[model samples]
Target: MSGNVLSIADRQPEDVQRRAVAAVSLQRWREIEHARVVKKGGVPVQTDQGSDLPASLDAWYRSQPVKPGRISPRLTLTDDEKRAYGLPKSARLIALRGLGDEVDHWSVAVFPVMGGYVVGVKAPAGGGGVGVFWRLSHKASDYARRLSVEHGMLIRERYA
Candidate 1:
């Protein structure tokens, strides 16, 4: 296969996350937010939506579409899309969710940046990408673990 056929999957997950982070520019850095924890059905805990952001990025993100349902059980990627967007083609789109609940109210958008793609995630609670929203509803243990212990939602063992 040609070099162009090479994808981000070949790299480690941490490397892919790091490289994508590194590709962000000082100016664009101002565009995204961080440490924004939000309630399942409420606004973000905090953010800088008023902070100056690129018009293109702003418009682009605003115009992007959303898919509330979970795309996959795992952070799966559209192989061709990852390459087209300058992400590690091998790495899946990283989405952390306790379960697929309310996924239909969220969207995973891709914004082109200095060196790589900024994986823009939009949840119904708030509207932003990347570090903008830390959704508690979709947190890892919120679904699987909590249900398993509280409601007896678990896999029972069976002899072969």
Candidate 2:
């Protein structure tokens, strides 16, 4: 692994969380929030609009096109987000919730078919479909686990 990645391995937990949040594209994170809302049947929750984000996430969102005619923008997840969401050993299927913006801001909610925190939700600035959300290539769960552990370690180190 690269030295930078190894450095991330030693970061504090909060730093890892911050980096994890920053690593994902703005649209992907929005989709996660949107999916969360759908799973809750359009329930209300605090939304993370692009305006409130740090430079890393906010800067990227500024360059992307807003989905069609939607007022709020959406963020999509990278393969890494899939890895995090896919970690629940007992999770059979992960369901993607569309979007819920009725009460406040827009967000997506995802829930396991069996039920649990395996689901992740993200909010978008403009109303739109999950933007550029991509699934990870097929691989053994062991491989996924390894990646998760490596990622977790890297995150811990980066924040340390």
Candidate 3:
């Protein structure tokens, strides 16, 4: 998680900020990464969430080092959950921080709106902030729309 968070330090602010809008997306990425690296002795793979590890060697994979508590963990969509949501069997997920690229080093929430088949958007955090970015995919775009409708209202009521 720290590696992902710390990587934020080196990324283009605009990019990170764009992705951070939908905090859930970041959370999802965390979950995916965690699931992939739970063991050791597996083949190295790159997941949409980044760094894919086989189930066997997941426990032993060298985790990406990060500053303690530098950033919160990411949420993930399981294969079954994603399928239930009408998402593709395989879709990419990524999480990024909206620091340096904007004021107060705020973070963003993002994810595949639907099944990452077309487009996606960020759901912004507070004070009329910008949302995160999603790659073009139906799943991602649909999720973005749902986020705008569901979480968007909640966020607006709470933070607005």
- Candidate topping lDDT: 3
Best to worst by TM-score, what's the order?
3, 1, 2
TM-score of each: 0.20, 0.19, 0.28
**Which 10 residues in a row give candidate 3 its minimum summed lDDT?**
53-62
Compute the lDDT of residue 148 as modeled in candidate 1.
Answer: 36
Worst 10 residues of 1 by lDDT: 128-137
By TM-score, the better pick of 2 and 3 is 3
Model 2, span 1-160: residue lDDT tens: 5554546545668878777778777779778977887787776445433343323322334445668887544555343333344432322322223433322343333222221222222334432222122233222324333433533321110010
Off by over 4 Å in 3: 1-76, 84-86, 99-140, 154-160
**What's the CA RMSD for each of the models?**
20.5, 19.6, 22.0
Question: What lDDT would candidate 3 get against the real structure?
Answer: 0.39
Better of 1 and 2 by TM-score: 1
Which runs of model 1 end up more than 4 angstroms from their true locations?
A: 1-75, 98-119, 126-160
Candidate 2 wrongly placed segments (more than 4 Å): 1-54, 57-59, 64-103, 106-126, 129-132, 136-160
Against the true structure, candidate 2 reaches a TM-score of: 0.19
lDDT of 3 by residue, 73-117 (tens): 333446643444444556443432331122232222332233323
